[model samples]
Target chain A: MRIVVVAGGVGGARFVRGVREEVQRHRPGSTVDVIVNTGDDWWLAGLRIAPDFDSMLYTLSGQNDEERGWGRVGETERVSAELHAYGVAPEWFTLGDLDLGTHIARSAWQRAGATPSDVARRLQERWPLGVTLHPATDEEVDTHVQLAGDSAGEVRELHFQEWWTRYRAALPAARFVQHGIERAVPSPGVLDALLDCDTILIAPSNPVVSIGTVLAVPGMVEALTAEAAPIVGVSPIIGGSSVRGMAEACLSAIGVQTDAAAVARHYGLRRDGGLLDGWLVGLEDATAVDALESEGFAARAVPLWMRDLDTSAALAAEALDLALALRP
Target chain B: MRIVVVAGGVGGARFVRGVREEVQRHRPGSTVDVIVNTGDDWWLAGLRIAPDFDSMLYTLSGQNDEERGWGRVGETERVSAELHAYGVAPEWFTLGDLDLGTHIARSAWQRAGATPSDVARRLQERWPLGVTLHPATDEEVDTHVQLAGDSAGEVRELHFQEWWTRYRAALPAARFVQHGIERAVPSPGVLDALLDCDTILIAPSNPVVSIGTVLAVPGMVEALTAEAAPIVGVSPIIGGSSVRGMAEACLSAIGVQTDAAAVARHYGLRRDGGLLDGWLVGLEDATAVDALESEGFAARAVPLWMRDLDTSAALAAEALDLALALRP
Candidate 1:
C-alpha cells in the first residue's frame, strides 16, 4: 500500500511512529509516507529550529523523549544556559540540548541556500524511511493562534508553541492563521505524495488548526479535493473534547462545533463541498455515525486511543481499509 | 591607564579573565579594552559562534564555568544529543547546551546583518566590564592548522578545535593558515584602539595561531609598530614547556625554538621588522631574559604562574609596570 500520512508534531509523530511499527510487521512493500507540518518552526537564538519536523524525525528513529513527548531522551541544557550567559535568551522554552542540533543542521542548510525540502531530503536519506518523509511546505508557514483580549485588546498572534507550551492552550484561542501559506510551496514531493498516493490518512490531529493549516496552504486543499483516491480523516475530537492541545479552543475560534459530527461536517461531505471521502469517529461517538451517513459521507466508529503502538496501528489499518473500500 | 586586551579563546581568554580583575582594583577611569580575535569565528548549524569572545565575556561577568574554563556555569548538553539524533553531528567537537544559546543569538544578529562587533556590543551591553570589547576583524577568517602525517593525515587543514581537541595537537604541525586574513579589515575601532593605546599587550596566547593570527592581519603589525607605546608581551611558554596546548608542536613546525626566549624572539622586535620595546618571561625562564635582550628586545622576568586571580593580577600589574618603565 502506498500510504501517505500527514502529521503535526507530538500527536502526529506518535501516530506515524506507530504506523511504521505496523508496516514493519507486514510485507516489506507497504511503503509509508509522512507529510509533516512545518507550521511550528521558529528561530531560537541563531538557529532555524523546526520543532514539528524534528519531533517527527526523532519519533521515527525511536529517539524521542517519551516523557516530554518531544526532543531526545538524554537531552541536556548546558548550551542553552551558555546562550543565556551571552544574554540572548528566551529561557522559558524547553529546548533540549540534543534538539538544538537538528535546528542547527536545518538552519545551516537553509543559510547556505538550501530549501527546506533539500534539508528534509538529506535527513530522510539517513533513514530511507522504508517510506519517504516530507515537510508540508518548503517555505516557512507558521500557524499562529490569536487569543482573546488581555492588553492587546482583542487578539494577538501567538506562535503555536506559545499557545500550546507556554499558555498550555488555556488562553481562549480566537483562530489559527497559517502565516505565509500563500507564498509557501509544498516540500518537493508532498503534493505528489498526496495526489498520487493509493491512500491519504489525516491522523487524529487538531482539525481547525493542525490539519486545517495543512489544508489551508494555497493549493493543498485543491489537490486533496481533486484527488479521486480515497482521503480519510480520523476525528481528533472524540466526543466534544480535544485528544490533546487546544483543539476545542481552536475549533470554537473558527465557529465550528467541537463534536465528532461537527468535525466531519467541518470537512463536510463530497456533494456539499468538503474534503472528507470518509470520516471515522471513536466508538464513544457512535451517534456521529448516523449524522455522517445522513450527510452522504462514508463514516465509521472505532477505538481511537493511541495507548500503544498496536492500538495506533489498528486505528491506522481501519482508516486505510476505509480508504481502500472507497477506492473506485 | 586604560588597558586593552587582544585575545582568542582558551589561553587568551584566561589571560583576560585575570586582566579584568587587575583593572578593577585600580582607581576609577582606569579601563580595560579587549580586542577579541574573530578569525576563529564560524557559523555552526547557523549560529554565529565566537568561542573566544564569549569565554572572556562570561569570565568577566563572573559566570564562567571554572571546571570547563569555557562556557557558562550550570550549563547542560541536551542540545548535542538532539543533534546526534538527527545524524547532523560534528560530534568531535562539543557544543554545550548553554553555549549554543550564545551562538544562536549571534547567528540571528548576523543573519539580520549585524556584524560580529555589533553582536559583541549587544552581548556586553548589560555586563559591567567597563571596558570596550571589539573583535579583531569583523570578517569570517577561520584558522586552519595543517598537520604533517597522522591518523587524519596529509594536506588537510583541521578546524582549530579538531586540531586542538580531537588530535590533541599530537601530529607534526606543518603550517598554520589564517584563511581569508589577506582580504580582511580590522573591525571598526580596532586599529584606532591599537594606535591610540598607551601600552599594547600581546597576551601570552599561543603564538603560532591565536595571537599570531591577530598580528598577521595586513595593517595590524604596522599599527603596532607605528605606536611608540611599549609593546610588551608575556611569555605563553616557560622553560621548554607551553603553559597550555602544544606550543612546542607549533614552534617545531616553524623551526623556531620552543623555549621562553624563542617565543619572545619569534614575536621578536617585530613582524616584518617591528619589535616589542619590552617582553615578560616567567621566573622559571629567567635565563632567557638575556637571550630575549640579545634579540634587541628589552625583557623582564616575572612570576607568571597564574595560580589564582590575585597572582594573575599581580603578574599583569608587574608586566604593566615594566612596559611603563620601558617608555623611551
Candidate 2:
C-alpha cells in the first residue's frame, strides 16, 4: 500500500512517526508520503522559520523535544535574552540559542540551493528516517489572521503568531486567510501522490488553518477527489476539546463547533463528491455515527488519542482499516 | 571648523577616538565627519557586518573592546561553538555573543525600513558621541584579494577578517579589487563634509584598502581638490611595520613599499594632481622632509606613535596645525 498523509505540525508529526513504524512492520511493502503544511512559515530576524515543516522533520528525525513536542531539546536562551535587550524583541516567540543553530543552517543551506523538502531530507539524514516528506508547495504562502479590534470595522492582518500567541485568541477574527495560495501550485510529487495513492489520510490536525491551507493550494483538492482510493480524515477535535492546542480557535474562526461530529461535518461527508471518503471520530463520540452515516459517508469511532508510540500506531491502524474498508 | 577624517577599521577607530576629542575641544563649532571604508563589509550568518563602520561606531560610543580593539566586551562564545559544530567554523574571526547583538539589531532595524544612516543615528543617540560617522556608501563594496597559492587561479572572496585573521595576511596577493565600488555612491555627508571641511585629516590607516577605497568613491577625490582646505594624510606605516594589522600586506598587493614615505608617495605628492596638500610623517621619518618640500607638500615630522590617548591627542594636534597652515 502507498499511503499519503496530509499533515499539519506536532500531531501530524507524532502520527506520521507511528505510521512509518506500522508500514515497516505489518504493511511491509507500504510507502509513506507526507504532504506537510507550510502555513506557519514566517521570516524572523532576517531568517525564515518554517515551523510546521521543521516540527515534522525534527520529530521524524528524533531530534524534537520529547517533553514539549515542539522545538529542539537542549536549547539555550542566551541569544533570546540578548535580542530582547536590543529591543528587536518580539515578546511572544522566544528564539532559543541552540534552536537558532538549526535555523541558521537551514537559511544558509537554502541560500546554497536546496529546497525545503531537500533540506528536510538532509536534516532527516541525521536520524536516517526512511520516508518521503514533501512541502505542499515550494512557493511562499503565509497564513494571516484578519482581526477586528476594539474599534468596530477596523481590521488588520496579524501574523499567525500574534493571533495564536499575543492575543491568546481573544481578538474577534474577521477571517483567516492563507495569503498567496491562489498562486501556489502543488510541488511536483504532490498531485500524483494524491491522485495515484492507495489511500490518503488527513492527520488529526488543524483544519481551517493548517490542512485547510494545504488543501487551498490550487488543484490539490481536485486531484485528491479524483483518486479512486479511500480518503480518510482523523478528527483533531476529541472528547469535546482539542486533542492538543489552538484548534478550537481555528474551528471557531470558521464557525464550527468544537466537537468530533462538527469536525466531521466541517470537512463534510463527501463519499462521492469532495476530498474525504472516510471520517474517523473519537471512540467517545460514538453518538456521532448516526448523524455521520446520515450524511452518506463511511464513519467509524476509534481511539484517537496518541499518548505514546503504541497508542499512536494503533490509531494509525484504525484509520487505515477504516480507509481500506471504505474503498473495499 | 568642519573636519573630515578618512578611516579604515580598528586602528583607524583608535585615531578617530582621539579626533573626536580634538574636534569637540579645539574646534568647538566644528563637526567631525568620518568617511569609513566599507570594503570590509560581508554577510555573516545572513546579517551584514561593516567591520570598519562598526569599529568606528563602537569606539565613538565608548563601548569598544579596548584590549581586543574589536567586538563587544563581556562577550560569550556559545554561537561560535554552535556555528563550528555546523561545519561553519570560520575559526579565524570569532563573533562574540554580545557583539552579535549589535549586528542582529542593525540588521533587523535595516530590514524594518531604517536606512544605514538612520540606524547609525539611532545607535549614536544612545552614546551621544561628539562626531559624525558614515559608511563610504550605502551600497556593499567588498575588498577581494587575488592570492598566489596552491589554489592559484581561484579568486575566492575573503571577508576582510579572513584575510586579517584566518590567513593572518599569510597569503600573497596579485592585486586587490574593490568589488561593487562602481555601483556605489558615497554615503550621506561624505562628499559634502570633504568639500565644506575646514581641514581634512586622513587617519594613519591602511592606505590601499582603506583610504584608497574611500577616495575611489565617485567625485570624492574631486571634492577634496575643490575644497580650499589642505588635505593632510598620516601614515599607517611606521618604523617599517604596520602600526597594527595588514598594512604591509595591503601595500604589497598594490606593489608599494611598506614605508612612511612610500605610503605618502603612493597617495602621490599631488595624487597625479588629485589627493593631498600636505603629508604628516613620524619623527623618525623626519629626514624624508627634503623630498617632501620638493614634491610641493609641507611635510611635518610629529610624534605619530599613538600608544595611548595622550600620544594620539598630541599627534592629532600636530596634524590639524599642518592642515591649518596649508589651507589655501
Candidate 3:
C-alpha cells in the first residue's frame, strides 16, 4: 500500500509518527510519503532552517525530545547562545547545537546547488526513517503574517516564525501570506505521491499555514481533485480548541471557527469541489459528526488525543479506517 | 603613539597581546593596529573560517583555550560532530560551538555585502580588544599548498587549513600559492596603518603563509618600503628552528633556511629594498646578529620565549625599543 501525508511541524511530526506506526503494524510493506510544508522555513545566521522537515527527521529517527515536545533530545544551545551574543537577529528562535548540524548541512548542500528535494533525500539517508519526506515546494514560499489594526493603515509584515515563535502568536494577524506561492509548483515526487497513492491523509497540523500552504501550491489542488485516492483529514481542532499549537490564532486570522465541524467545512467536501472525502473529529466533538455528514463529508468521531505512541497509532488506524470506508 | 603589527594565528595572537600590554604600561594611550593574515581563511560549510582573525579575537578577549593552544576556552563540538556525521567534507578540521558563532555571523555579514574590514570592526565591538585588527587583504587570497611530489604529475593543491590542520603540515609542500594575490590589495586601513604609524613591528608568526602572504599583497611591499616608520621584524625562527607551529615546513617550501639570520636575509634589509629596518633574533641566535648587521639590518638578540604575559610584554618592549632606535 502507498500512502501520502501532508504535514506541518511538531503536530504534524507526531501525527506522521502515528501513521508510520499504524502502517508498520497492520499494512506491512506499505510505503509512506510525507509532503512537508516549508512555509515556516527561514534563513537564520545565513543558514537554511526548515523547521517542519527537521521535526519530521528528528521525530521519525527517535532523536526528538519527548519532554520538551520539540527539537532533538540532549541538545545544547551553545552556538545559539553565541549567535545571540553576536547580536544576530531573531534571538527568539534558538536552534540547538545538534540541530544546527542539520541546518548547516542543508545550507551547504543548498549553496552547492542542491534543490530542497535533494537535501531532503540526503538528510533522510542519515536514518532509517521508513518514510520518504518531500518538501511541499522547491521554491522559497516562506509564510509572512500581516498584523491586524495598524494605525494610519501602516502595514506590518512579520515572518511566520517571528509571529509564531517570537511573539507566541499573541499578536493579532490580519492574514497569512506565503511569499511566491502563486508560482510554486509541487516539489519533485509530490505530484506522483498524491496521484499514485492509495490514500492521502492530512495530518492534524496548522490548517492556515501547514496543510493550507501545501494545498495552496499552484498545481496541488488540481492534482488532489484529479486523483480517486480517498482523501482523509484529522481535525487539528477538537471541542472548539486546537489539539496542539496555536492553530486557533491561525484559523481566526482566516476567520475560521475553532470547531471540528467548522474545520471540516473549511476543508469542505470533494463532492462540493473542496478537499476531504472523510473527516475524523475527536470524541469530544462527537456532536459535530451529524452536521459534518449533513454537509456531505464522511465524518466520524474517534479518540483523537495522541498522547503516546499507542494512542497515536490507534488514532492513525481510525483515520485510515475512515479513509478506506470513504473509498469509492 | 600609533603602532602597526603584522601577525598570523596563535603565535601572532600571543605576540599582539604582549604588544598591547607593553604599550598600555609604557606608552599610555598609545594605539596598536594589527594587520592580520587572511591567507589561512577558507569557506567551511559555507561559513568563512578566518583562523588568524578568530585567534586574535579569542586570544585578545581572553576566551581562547590557552592549554589546547586554540579555539574558545569552554568550547563544545556538537555542531562540528554533527557536520562530520552528516558527511560534510574536511572532517579533520572541527569548529567549536562558540567559535561557529563568529563564523556564522561573519558569513552572514559578508553575504550581506560587508567587507572583511567591516566585519572585523563589528567583531571587535563584542570584546574590548585594545588593538584594532585589519585583514591583510579585502580580497580572497587563500593559500593553497602544492604537495612536493605528485605521482604522474597530477598536481594536488590543498587549502592551507587542510595542509596545516588535517595533514599536520607533514605533507611536504613544494610551494605556497595565494590564489588571488596578483590583484589583491590591502584591506581597508591596512595601508594607512602601515604608512601612518610611528613604528611597525612584524610579529613572530609563520613567515611563509602568515607574514609572507601579507607581504605578497600587491601594494604591501610598496607601502612598507615607502614608509620610514622603521619596520622591525621579530624572527619566528630561533636556534635554527621555528618558535611555534610548522613555520619550518613553510620556510623550507619556499627554499628559505630555518635560521634567524636566514629569515632576516629572507625579509632582507630596508636599505637593500627589503622590509626590515631592524631584526630581533632570540638570544640563542646571538651568533647570527653580526651577520645580520653586515647584511644591512640592525640586529638584536633578546629573550624571545613568550612563556607568560610578563615575558611576552618584555619581548614586545624590546621590539619597540629596537624599532625606535632604528627610526630615521
Docking class of 2: acceptable
Top candidate when judged by DockQ against the true structure: 3
Best-to-worst DockQ order: 3, 1, 2
What's the i-RMS of each model? 2.9, 2.3, 0.6
List the candidate numbers ranked by lDDT, top first: 3, 2, 1
Better of 2 and 3 by DockQ: 3
What candidate 3 gets wrong by more than 4 Å, as runs, is B151-153
Tens digits of per-residue lDDT, candidate 2, B1-328, equal: 8888889988888888788777666778878888888887777766667788888877777777888768776667777676666654466667776666677777878878887777777666656778888777777678777776566467666556577677888888677777767887876667667766788888998898888888887766777677777889998877778888777888887889998888888887654675777888888888887898788777878888888877787788888889888776
Candidate of highest lDDT: 3
**Cα misplacement distance, residue B168 of candidate 3 (Å):** 1.6
Instruction: Output the worst ten-in-a-row residue range by lDDT, candidate 2 chain B.
Output: B82-91
- Using TM-score as the yardstick, the better of models 2 and 3 is 3
Please state the Cα-based DockQ of model 2 relative to the true two-chain complex.
Answer: 0.39
Expressed as tens digits, the lDDT of each residue in B142-168 for candidate 3 is 999999875777778899899999999
Model 3 global lDDT (CA atoms, 0 to 1): 0.91
The sequence of per-residue lDDT tens digits that candidate 3 reaches over residues A147-252 is: 9965968779999999999999999999989877889999977987876678889999989899998889998877877888899999999888998889989999
**Candidate 3 CAPRI assessment class:** high
What's the true lDDT of residue B7 in model 2?
90
Q: Quote the lDDT for B18 in model 1.
A: 73
Task: Give the distance in Å from residue A313's predicted Cα in candidate 1 to where it truly belongs.
Answer: 3.2
Q: After superposition, how far is residue A198 of candidate 1 from its true place, in Å?
A: 2.7
Task: Supply the TM-score for candidate 2.
Answer: 0.88
